[model samples]
Target chain A: MIPARTWPLGRAGVHLVLILYTALCLGPVLLVVMNSFKSRAGIFGAPLSLPNAATFDLIGYKTVLGQGAFLRYFGNSLIVTAGSLAAVLLFGAMAAFALSEYRFRANRLLGLFLALGIMVPIRLGTVAILNMMVAARLVNTHLALILIYTAQGLPIAVFILGEFMQGVSKDLKDAGRIDGLSEYTIFFRLVLPLVRPAVATVAVFTMIPIWNDLWFPLIVAPGEATKTVTLGAQVFIGQFVTNWNAVLAALTLAVLPVLVLYLLFSRQLIRGITAGAVK
Target chain B: MDQIDKLAADVPLLPAATRDAAPARTRRWHIAVFLAPALLVYTALMIVPLADTLRLSLFRSVEHAPVFVGLDNFRVLLTDPRWSLHFWAAFRHNLYFFAFHILLQNPVGIALAALLSLPRLRGQAFYRTAFFLPTMLSFVIVGFTWKLILSPLWGVAPALLGSVGLRGWFHPWLGQEATALTTLALISVWQYVGIPMMLIYAAMLAIPGELIEAAELDGITGFAQFRKIKLPLIWPTVGICSILTFVGNFNAFDLIYTINGANAGPNFATDLLGTFLFRTFFGNQLQLGDPNMGATIATMMFLIILAGVAAYLFGIQTRMRRYAL
Candidate 1:
C-alpha cells in the first residue's frame, strides 16, 4: 500500500537512480578489496572480473604481515581514538552541562568560542603545536596525538551537546538539585542517560577523524611503535609502491577493521544522527 | 513554581521551602570543576597554539631563535616572484578544488537525498550504509585504491572505458598536470558525497509529515512537490553543507598528499594551499624548511578561512530562513 505521507512518483525510475548512484559510491572500494585477493597478473589482466582459481592468491597478505607492524599501528590508532573519544564525550558533556544548565555571565562568550573553532582549522597551529609537543616531551607518544585530537573535537562536541542538553527537562535537573544531589551526581546519574543518544552522535563524529587522520600522527607520532594505522598505511604504500598485490593487501587489511566496527555500530550511529538532527 | 513546592514537600528537605532557592554559593564551584578539563585542554593545546602560530608569522628565525620581523615574511611571500608564483598557483588550484565540490558533490548529494527520503522508498538503510562506507576509509587507502584503478599500468580505467566504447578518451588522469587536480577532486567527491546526503536527508526527514500530506492533497506531487514543499524547509541545511564543503576543501591535504606526495605535482599541478603549506613548512628536496614562511602561509590559510566563515555568518547565512518546524 502507498504510505500516507509519501509522494506518488515514478517508483521504477527512482529505484534505477538510487541503484546506479549506490554502485558508483561502493564500486571502487569493492574493486580494491576484490583485486587484493588476486595475483598481480590477475589484477592487471582483467581488472573488473572475479578472481578465478588460478588467480586466487594469499601472497599479498603474507607480504604485508611479514613486512609491517600493521597490528601494532592499529593498536596505537585504537588507543588514541578511544582515549580522545572518552575525553571529548565526558569533558564535552560536563562543559555542555555547565554552559546549558547554569546561566553564567561568560555563556555568550563561550558560545562565540565554539563559532571561532569552526574557522580555525587546528592544523594551522601545527607549527606551534609541534614546538609545544617537543617542549612537553610528548613527541612520538600516544598522549601527544590524544591531546591534540581531544582538543580538536571538544569545541564541536560541546557546541552540539550543549544545545541538545538544553532540551533536557530543566525541572528534572532542579528536582535533583532540590533533593540535595550535587551537580556532578546529577550530571552522571540523571542528565547523561537522557543525552546518551546525543553523545553517541557526537561520538561517531569525533571518532572518525581521529581514526583516519594522517596529520597529527605524521607530525608527532611517526615513530615505529607509535604510528597510527593511517600513517602506517602511508609508509607501507611508499615501501611497496611497485608491489601491486602487497599494496592491495595492505589496503584491504587497513579497511577491514573499520568496516567491521562500522557495521557493528552503524545502526546506532544513523539513529543517533537522526535523533540529534533536531536543530 | 507550584510543582517545585509540592516536590519539595514530598522530599526530605528540612530547610525552609526551597522553592526559588538561590544557587548555594558553596556549590557554585562545581561549574568551574565541570568546565576545567575541557577548557584547559582546548585552550592550552588548541587556542594557545593558534595564537602562537599567528605570532610566529610576524617573526623570522635568526640564529635558530625566533626574531620578530613584522610583516616581512608576508611581503616576501606576496611580492617575491619566486615565492609568489607557487603561492598564487596553489591558491588558484585550491579554488578549483573547492569549485569541483560545490558544483558536483552538493548536487549529487541533494539529488540522492531527495530520492531516498521519499516515503515509500525501500532499502533506505542499506543504501545509506553503502554510500557512507567510503568516508570511513583513510585518505591513504582511498588515494591508493583510486590510483591503482586509474593507473595506466593496471588498465582498469581504460578497460572499463573500452567496455563502454570510450576507451580512446581514457588517459592517466592522475599523472597528467591538467587533469590530476580535477581527477583527485572527483575522487574526493565520490568519497564524500554521502556526508551531505546524510545531513540533507536527515533534514528532509525533519519536515513535518502534515506538510507533505497537505501538498499531496493540493495535487502537487513528485519532483514538483519536492521543489515547493521540501526545498524551502531544507534550505538551511543545504547552506550548512556548502559551508562545510568550503571549510573541508580548504583544509584538505591528506588525499592530495597520499596520491601526489608533498610536491603536489605533476609539476605542481595538483598543488593546493594545504600541500603547499606542508611543503613550505617541512621543506622538500629543493629548499630548507622555513618555519616563518610556513607560519605566514598558515596565517594566510587562517585568514582565508576566517573570511569564508565570516562571509557565511554575515552574508549568506543571514539571508537564509530557518523554517520553524
Candidate 2:
C-alpha cells in the first residue's frame, strides 16, 4: 500500500468533490422531508430552514394520513415483497443448486435459458403477462404481483446464488451423501445454511425492486385494495398535485420507511454490492 | 483405512452395492425436483410471456378478434406517419436519455469509485452510504422529491441556486419541452450513479495490492497508475456497467411515468419506449388501449435491447477478459 502521508491539497480536493456530490444526491430528499413538517407559508417562504416553533406543523401529515389508503398500500407492499423474497430465494436456490452441483443433459441450456431474463427485462412481456393474469382471473390480486416479482427477481438471484453455490465445498456435500443424506436433505440442511450470506445478498436484490416497482403493480394490481406503496404514492400525489402540503407529506411518507431501512442495512448492502457478490 | 474410505466414497457410480441399485436415469428425478419450480415460475411468467408478446405483435385486432397480420403493425409503426411519428419520437427520446446517462452517470460513478478507493481515505463508508441513499428510494419518492424542489412555487431550487449566485438560471426544467427529458435523465443519473460506483469500487478493490505496490516502486503512482494498471483491470466491469445502463435505460418507465404522468407530457417530449409502451398498452387520455400495438412496441424494444446485448456479448465482451483476482 502507498504510505498514508500528507497530500493536504489533494485530500481536501477529494473531500470537497465528494461532499458536494453527496449533498446533491441527498439535498432534494432532505428538502422534501424538511419542508413537509413546515407550515405552508414556511415551506414556500423559507424552504431551506429547519422547522421552528412557529413554522412546525402536522397539517400535511394529517391530510396525507387522512385521505390515502397508505396503511393498506404498506401492507400490500410488505406482503408482495416478503412473498416474492421467500419464493425467489427458495426456488432460485434450488435451481441454482441443481445447475451448479449436478450434471444433467440440459443443464447448460437451462442455465442459459434462465439467465436470459437478466439482460432482457420482464416488462417487455407485460402485454402477455396482463393477459395471462386476466385469463387466470388473478388480476387485481396480491398473487399476480407476487408471481411476477418472483419471476422478475429469480434470474439474478439464481445467477448470483449459482456462482456462490459453485464455491461450496463438495467434500461437505459428499460427506452429507456418505452420511445417508438425500440430495434434498443435503440442500436444505447442509447447503442452504452454508450459503446464507449469499441469501442475504439475494434478499437485498430481490426486496428493493419488489418494494419499489410501479409498472408491474400498476398493470397487474392497480386496484386500491392491492396498490403497493409506490403505486399508491404515485396515484395520491397525482390527484393532490396542487396541495403542496399533502404532496410533500405523501412523498415523505413514501420515503421514510425506505430511508430508515437503508440507514440500518447500508453496511451490509454496500458490502454485498462491493463484494461483486451479486453480479 | 483412509484410502479405503476414499475408494468407497468415490466408487458410488461403480458396481458398489448401494449405488448399483439405482441407475443414472433412475436418479434423474432428483434434478427435476430441484429445477422444476424455478423453471415453471420463470418460464410461465417471464419467458413464455416474452415469446407470447412476440406472437401478439404479429397479430392485429379486427372486429374484437386478433387476426394474423404478420409485419403489418411493425409496418405502421415504422412507415405510417401517424403511428410512426409517436413511435420514432419516443424512440428518439429514449436514445437521448441513454446518451445522457452514458455521458454523465458512468464517468461520475467511475470518478467517485476512484476517490473512495484512494488509500487511507477517511469516512469512506459514510460517503458511500450517503451517495447511495437515493438509489434505495422508490422512483415515486425521487421523482416527487425532485419535482417539489424544482417547483417554481416552492422556491427551493431557486433558493439553492441563489445561494450559488445563479438564481437567474432557475426555471421549471421539468415542465419545459426542450429540457424535460434531459432533466429527467439527469435526475435518474443522480439516483443510480451509486450502482456503478459501488460495482467499480469493488472491482478496483480486487486489483491485487502487490500490483499497485510494484507500480509505486517504479515511481508510477496516482493517476498514472490508475490509467495504466487499474483502468485496464476494471475494463470488464466497465463493460458490464455499460450494458446495464443500456438495458436499464430502455426498461426505465417508473421515473418518467411517476414524474410526467402517462402522457409523458410537454407535448410528449419525454416519451420513452417504456412510457410509450405503457400508454399504448393501457389506454391513457390520448387513445384506447391496444394490446396488439403495445405488443408490437414491446417487441421492438426487446429487439433493440437484444441487438445491444448481442453486440456487447458477441462484439464487445469477447475481448474484455476478467482477470482472475
Candidate 3:
C-alpha cells in the first residue's frame, strides 16, 4: 500500500482484455440459443435481439420434438456413455492397480501398449473394426459402441489412474491385508473409494468423446434406433437445412444436456484439469 | 476438514474382515483377473484392428480373397493422378489447417492463459469457464451454431460486424472456396483454444510462487517478468500444446464433416484426410468403396502422426527440461 505497483497494462486494461475474450467465446453460443426461441421473421429480421412476445415461437422445438427421434437418440447416448464409463472405470482401475501395485514381468511393455491409444486415436482402426463388428454381427448394437468406446477410453484412464494409484499409501493396503481382506476386496473397497477424485476426472474425460462421437455412430450404427444425439442432430440438421427454426432448435437440443452436465460438474472438472491429471 | 471428511467417507466402504475370511494360500490370479478385462477389450478392439488395417494396406482383393500386393496401394495413392490429385490437395488443406491453429490458436491461448494467470485477477473462473464452454459442446452444436451465425441471410455476423464498423468484411466465408478452409480453421480454433489455454495455465500454476516473489524483488515484473521467468518455465507445456494441436488439427473431421458434409463441398475445398478416409471406405458418388485404399490412407495418416510425435519426442522435447520449482 505504501508504493503502488505499475503494470504495462493497468488493472482496468487487463480486465478489458479478459472481458472482450470472454464475450468472444460466449457470444456465438448465446446468439444461437437466443435465436432458437425467435420466430422465423424475428430470426431473419433482428437476429441479435432477444425474443419478445411478438417474435417468440416454440414451433422449432415442437417440430424438432415431433418430427425427429431425438428422445431415442438421447437414450442411446445415455446407454452408451453410462455403459462405456462403467466399463472404462472398472477395467481401467483394475489394470492400473495391477500395473502400479504389483511389479510383474512385462509390466512396462504392457503399460506402454495401453498408453499408445492416449496419443493415437482409435478411429484409424475403423476399417478393421467395421469388418470385425460385421463378422461378429455386433453392428448397430449398443454393446458394440460400448466395447469400442471402453477400448478407446481405457488407455488414458489407466495412465491417469495408475499415476494416482502409485500415490495411495502402501500402509493402507497393507493394513487391509492384515485385516484379512482379500486382494479383490482391497481393490473394490479400499482402493476404489480412495481414488474417487481420479474416477471423476476419468469420467469427465471419457464421457465427452463417447457421447459426442459422430464417426463411430455414423459408421457402426447409423440406424434410427442406434443413432446418438450427435449423429441424430447431424442427420436432422442435414435434412432440415432450409428450415432455420428447426435447425437451430435441433442444435440447441443437442447442446443443452451436455451444457447442463458441464455446469453441474464444472468445479470438479476444472480441478481435475488443474491438478495435472490431464498432463 | 476436507481430508477428514474424505477419510470418513472411505471408512464405511471397506467392511471389516475377520482373519478367518482370508484364504491360507497366496492367490496368484488376482493380478491377471484385474488386468484381463482391459487387456482383452483394448487388444481385440483397438490394437488388433489397427494391426489388421496395416496389413490390409499391403493387399488388394482378388476374386473375393485378398491378394498380396505389397505397397501398391500406397504407390497408387501417391503417384496415380486420379487418387494423388485429391490426396495431395487434401494434404495441403490439412497442412493449412494445422498452420492456422499453430499460428493463431496457440498464441491466442498463451495470451489468454497469461492474462488469466495474472496475480489478483478477479473473476478468473468466470472467464475460464466461459472460454471453455464451446469446447464442451458437441461438434454438431458448434458446427451448426456457427453455420447459422455465419449465414448471410439470417446470421448476426454481418450485423455485429456492421455495428463495429467492419461491415464490408462480412461475406459467406463458409461458401467461398478461397475463404472456406481458412474460415473453418478459425472456427475450429474458436472451439478449441480453451484446451491449450487450460494446459498452459496449469503449467503456469505449477511454477512456484517463491520464484515470482524473488523476481519481484529483483525488479523484474509485469510483461518482462513473464517474458524472462514464466515463459521459459512453461515451454514444456507450450510444446505439449503444439503437438496436441498438430495431432488434433490433422485428425480433425467432425466440424468440417458436420458443417460441410462428407463430400466437404464447395468443390471439396474443405476435405480432410478423415473425411477422405470415410468416403473411401464407405463409398461416395466419386468412387466405389475400397477397403484396401481406405486402409492405405489410414496407414498414411498413422505414419504422418507418428512422424510428428517422433519429431516432438526426439527434437523438441530434448531442448526443454522441467525446471525444478
Best by lDDT: 2
Tens digits of lDDT, candidate 1, B1-325:
9999997787666455463344545557998899899889999888999999899999998998888889999999998998999999999998998888989988888888898888767998898888888887778889999998899898888988998899999999999988999999999998888788888899989998887778878878777888898988888888888888988876689999999999998999998999888889888898888877988999999999889888988998899887777
Q: Among all windows of ten consecutive residues in candidate 3 chain B, which has the lowest summed lDDT?
A: B18-27
Go through the candidates in order and give the C-alpha RMSD of each one to the true structure. Answer: 3.9, 3.1, 6.7
Write candidate 1's Cα lDDT for A98-127 as tens digits.
Answer: 988877778789877865775588999999
What tens-digit string does per-residue lDDT give for candidate 3 at A118-169? 8788999999999999999999999899999999999999999999998899
Interface RMSD of 2: 1.9
Docking class of 3: medium
Query: Candidate 3: which pairs clash?
Result: none
lDDT of 2 at A272: 79
Cα lDDT of candidate 3 equals 0.89
Please give the distance, in angstroms, between residue A10's alpha carbon in candidate 1 and its true position after superposition: 2.2
Model 2 RMSD to the real structure? 3.1
